[model samples]
Target: MIGGFGMWELLIVLLIVLVIFGANKLPEIGSGMGRAIRNFKKATGEPEEIDVTPENEKKKEEGEKKE
Candidate 1:
């Protein structure tokens, strides 16, 4: 086993992710992961949620339009 994962097992998983998302998109995936965890914590009543709301959704749409 390598790093507690069987040799080549992690490589296989990473290859699958690369095939699915491509290398150029990995940073976008990581940022999305951060956003998902932040939202989950806020839903569970964490001290901060970064303001998730329908209003935020509307604002997002508006922001996209402005771009």
Candidate 2:
């Protein structure tokens, strides 16, 4: 059991999430959660190097490079 949650307990929580958010929205939720985690780590001074660029800015740079 990780973090005091047994396998069955974790499964139940996941089921609840699936019901509430549905499968289509799960990926979006996961990505947003991943971004939040990365930001939290950066804020704590644990990782000295990180890419802080917004997605649109990166896409713009790529477009300019290709032109």
Among these predicted structures, which one has the highest TM-score? Answer: 2
Taking all chains together, each candidate's TM-score versus the true structure is 0.50, 0.66
- lDDT tens per residue, model 1, 1-67: 7678985898898899999999999999999999999999878885554656688798899999999
Q: Count the backbone clashes (under 3 Å) in each candidate.
A: 0, 0
Q: Provide the lowest-lDDT 10-residue window in model 2.
A: 41-50
| Count of clashing pairs, candidate 1 | 0
Clashing pairs in 1: none
Q: Model 2, range 2-27, lDDT digits (tens) per residue? A: 99999999999999999999999999
Report the error of model 1 at residue 60, Å. 39
Model 2, clash count? 0
Model 2, TM vs. native: 0.66
Measured by lDDT, the strongest candidate is: 2
